[model samples]
Target: MAKGLLCSAMQMTWRWFSPDRTVTPRRQLRFPAYTPNAVSLALKSISKKTKCLPFGLRQPDRPLLLGGHSLDIVHCHQYLGVWFDSRLTFATHVHYIRERAATRIAALKALSHSNLGALYSVLQTFYSYAIHSIVDYRAVCLVEVLESLRLSLEVLQNTVLRVMLGAPPWMRLVNLRAESGFPSLQHRIWERTTAVIAQLCRHWPRFTVSVLLQRTLDRPPNPHPGGDWILLAADIVRKLDATNAICGGPDLPDPAYAPAPPWLPPLIRCVEPTTAVPRSSFPAVLCQDSLSHVAALSTPDAAVYYTDGSVSDDGSAGAAFVCDEWVESWRVTSSVSDYQTELVAILGTLRHADRHFYRCIIIHTDSLSSVCGLQTQRYTDNKYLTAIIAVAASITGQGGEVILHWLPGHVGIAGNERAEADARHAATFPVPTFQLHPSLSLLLRRVAYTVRHLSWEDHQFQIYEGSRSATWYAIETAYAPVTVPHGTSNYLLVSLRHLRLGFPCCGQMTNSNPEPCPHCFDISEQPLLHYVLDCPATSRLRCGISEQLHNRDEPFIWQQRLLHRHLPL
Candidate 1:
């Protein structure tokens, strides 16, 4: 009866809003269970299973009237590309994703041919943007779904990885992921979900989703059998140990007002080195000359201030501004990035200028990022930057002029040197807090650190469990620091990866029938090693390559040679 009244009210509301438009009953879905009585006409084509009643309750057969039309109920529906069912199991969605991913995986397979298809790197890029994007979309909402659903997604990822690498089904999943540098689907989902939760925590007041999340978290714990996304997110955060890293508090106001328009007279001036200034000039001399040039260019009455920001080895951040009349320094949260600290220094200078009603203010900073950010209006994304722009706009509105001068750092300009020292001191010894909220960059860094730590732990466990061979582990450890140089051919990368994994290209590692080396019929066992190092067929090439090595006297280890590690002198 309640559902009937709700339908009637919706019908009346729809007609009142749009008289010409009619409600489409066929598109609607009813949760938990559907009933035949809900429909006006007896539609024989409608399945009886869809209308199965809950708790064995039955009512007199009646039609659900909507805008003077009968409405039909559905057991499942698709909204925004995600399938939803009465039970909210997400099984339908997972199945759909697997089918969709299989289609793309087939396309990838078509491009995996050795000579006729696209490069491995190209295929990987396509997977990241095309296939992975589909699977990762709205994955945060699926955090609490059944383990089977999660495993299905994992299986989909594993299949894609196998197709991309052309790895045999016998290859272990851990080795496959390590070789490809792709984390497990579950880890990826957790990372993505944690990132979203961090963002929501930071901007809780700004977005509707954040507001809803905040409300949900504020209420008493109400356990749901299927589990709750918000609770799962909170648990993930706790596990990451990033509760303190979660940024909270309102964002700064937009600084796009007329007084601070992007077209406003050149406020930020970068000091470009000229041809007259020889590159071989002493650092101190160069800084002195630059300072003199800036002073000459500035207004005679303008108050010149030097601002600098610093980050200690321990990650504490500090910012300071030094002027003739007064000097101020602040110790910001360690999570605040060096770039943000630089902006904070500039912001302090602006606030000081505004407070003292300086007619002309010139702020000299060595941070080009901060200067560029101001010029490009990138301050909209950061609180300190936004505050800087706001204060600068206020100064400009009151018939005052503000200018920023970019100069080289650690070059010994007196005021800049003093500011730098004060910033260092502030960073070393905690001063008053400037801002407590962590910078977005720092939050992202923390999240990446947590994800990497977790991944490393998992990798170690895999190694301890004997999932990877010692030779494979040694190769991975050696090549961990090494990266493929730019412009490397796709064929070379694939060959190198195969070499690292000890893939049975030579058939010696195969369990069944092993084949002898084509070049050397005598060398049947360990054909890969013999082909690379012992084969007389490639002896001339090997000798030629050996002469180019730093130490030709030392024998080239297979691990070093195959992984392409630089030979020690």
Candidate 2:
């Protein structure tokens, strides 16, 4: 009678099964041969055989083994049917626990001390295994389970870090229980708690989750707290949101062009920031040459570096400068308002820097105009000049100084060759001139001269109009366009106009500039075909040009022929 009652109670409590390992109704009569231990063992096996239930196991609409459900193996005196998924794997473990409980009770009756340790180990193994087996469940429940496992393992805490030291190491109790540590064990636990909540908050932004994070953060680190990992996670999330907002969202006020600040890492624990050593171009820095001479000059007295510029009537200029550490003052000389001379002198000084104490010296320039422009005191009018100024500023900004001196010109001075070479080179460059209302004859002559001079093997010229210029088959890349913008065009044309001639415009090539007209040397109305085929005057000029040419009797072709006839000049 007692056996039958035990079976019935087990069936009512957990829907127990029998040999077939399935859920079914229990028998009314007690089996005379069966013991409670045998029945319990059968139940354990049956639980293990069951399949896990789906996620909807808690819903009444999805129950599988209850109600009128019955087993197919009823005749074998065993219960058998499809078991609920919840009872699949975990049910067997639970049954194992119950079986152990009975065994432990029996051992206690025999006064066995070893049984206590065995039971503890069994519980520890079960907890660890069960936690690992669970998947995609509630994080809150997982945290609670972890807390329970921690409390249960308190008595054997010393056994943890010992076995796990180098392999999947666990936190040592000694490390966590440190005295006067900024971050204690308690602090670490609390931070980890917040981290878990924050991670979950990413998927589920519930009010409860936020509250949990706040609570965890409010609590200080335990005895072994190190870095605020949770705060780092939170800050990362915030930055992500901020970045998204700045890209397009309405919440961000800044433009996408503005740079963002450096990210504060969550794991940094008061380590010093690192700085890179700057690379020096001087041979001493790279070759590790002895700096004994230079090093001695570094004292407060230092040296003076002088620079000078000059311009001559022969269309040349010169500059000279010297740096002397003994004097502590620069000796500089150069002409004022001269660009080429000053630039050449500057290059010369840079090349012969080893001749003086350039490392510890003050620079001096005679041209106040050039010095002021170089030193940002004056406005820069040319892009190339601006680039030079920028380079000088960068160099001087690094603890060097450049002083200006107004030296008088016309003195037969030294260092004039460099300035003369620069001026001569600048003058050697072909100046551009264009015709305003130019005659067709004069235009054709000029075009012929330009094409032959600019062309490499192929005789051609790039016509310029407004801000645009086109290169027509140059013999080499050495050829550069000779044109200026409308504003600068006036300057080049001034002398040509005085001589009653035309000059090319020196405008920058812009997308809006009109294409050049090949026939009339104008982009607005003279395309290449029109110049070669349509121009009446051009056609009259070249009656018998190349026979293979498409435009045989065309005025533009005639013009091209006439232009070519004067190529030698």
Candidate 3:
């Protein structure tokens, strides 16, 4: 499974390795006259001295000669537009990306301090569309490489948004990301990988499949053991196989051996053109915390059942059961999510505990939630949780005892890999009936999420429709739309709004009704416009405001319009 998963991941990586997209010096590498041109025209034309960058596994302190010219390799370099280090750890890459992104953010800060018209909006566009693309490019590969680097990328994005909103740097980042419509760095990476995987599964691109197949055909004994991607690729191949189950001899799969998930949502919505039907068993990618599963599985006389659940792009589900020598799988309905299916597979595995007579059986799952659910029983209110509890109750009636273990998916554990493969295979099975009965709480939460998203979008639309200033548009992109300017002016704007709505001014909201403008001690009602634009005490600031509009002699009507338009009170 590890071998296969590795091949699959390599395929994906290679597909993205488009030659045209690379920013390396490779285009000139193959040039016939490259060496002489570099010593002559290239060096003479350059203002700064040229440097050399090397990649790959072989490391040497000595420089390499290119047409008799020695090129020295330093510690870090950029390749294919992403940075790399001598160790290929991507640490340098992350640092380069961060520094470059920070420069843009600092530019934005400078722009804001300058108080240029519509500059905030410009910054917003730069961050939202352009900068994000720059930082997120090929992040799918880099994200899985290091957690710290992933967080760094996220922090960079947050810093950009925080600057635009004039928000405190110490603001809760999670809440801030959520409010600003930015998913966490990790989530964005996950989402992208998931989409790519789904596309790969759906299309089964010829080039990727052919290349991977050719590589696996060699299958040398004691092959180079790398990471879990090999196992993941193996699982994928097995699941896609039409006959000759990867593990179960050379015979075709047996339909009678298959089983379904113990529970599913009561209400299922059917979709047309479902996922591809399963041809063979499959498993999932390796997960984090795989070592625990490895350590626990080392016990003797304990049979490991790698069970997994999968949901396809169209929302169809499949559950797989992989015991020693036997592989069972079945397609399920939509309504149930990938996470729910994983938990449901665990429940099914638990119920099957009575069938297997092993003295100690290990039910291994890649789903973190399922493991947590079994331990905490937090999902008791949900139907799936109830189903899990019911199965768990019957466990005592069976053999010695079944231990539920959380095995990180895709790490290439034999049993776990088989289960994940089978589950994914089941997901592709074409089914006519799709039934689901979602628990009320589960249904409500999904609905609420959708509603909240729509409401936020609608609110944004209203703000856009009501205002024309680019600055407001940009700031509101990260914050709730507000007509008031940021800084101290926001306070004044909010207070003014309250006063207009029949609420007393800031000092004390007593029966004294509306208080006079405290700043100017005016006898007239403390209208915000008078205090902000026409008050004698504020005459100096008013002149500055007039100068901003390009002339101190501008009419009072212009000042009123500026306040009314921008302040919107």
In model 1, the runs with Cα more than 4 Å from the true position are: 1-63, 206-226, 247-296, 324-326, 376-380, 410-415, 474-488, 504-569
Deviation in Å, model 2, residue 57 alpha carbon: 78
Better of 1 and 3 by lDDT: 1
Please give the CA lDDT of all the candidate structures.
0.66, 0.32, 0.50
| TM-score between candidate 2 and the true structure | 0.18
The positional error of residue 403 in candidate 3, measured at the CA in angstroms, is 63
Query: For every model shown, what is its TM-score relative to the native structure?
Result: 0.75, 0.18, 0.34
Judged by lDDT, which candidate is best? 1
Which scores better on TM-score, 1 or 3? Answer: 1
Question: Mind sharing the TM-score for model 1?
Answer: 0.75
lDDT of 3 by residue, 181-260 (tens): 66655555544443333334223424464345334533532244343343334433333331121221111112222223
lDDT by residue for model 1 (381-404), tens: 677666776787788779788878
RMSD of each: 8.4, 36.8, 22.4
Q: Which candidate tops TM-score?
A: 1
lDDT of 2 by residue, 451-555 (tens): 333232221212232211122111111133222233332223222211111112222223356565534556543243354445544555335654524533343
Identify the superior model by TM-score, candidate 1 or candidate 2: 1
Q: Residue 544 lDDT in model 2?
A: 61
Higher-TM-score candidate of 2 and 3: 3
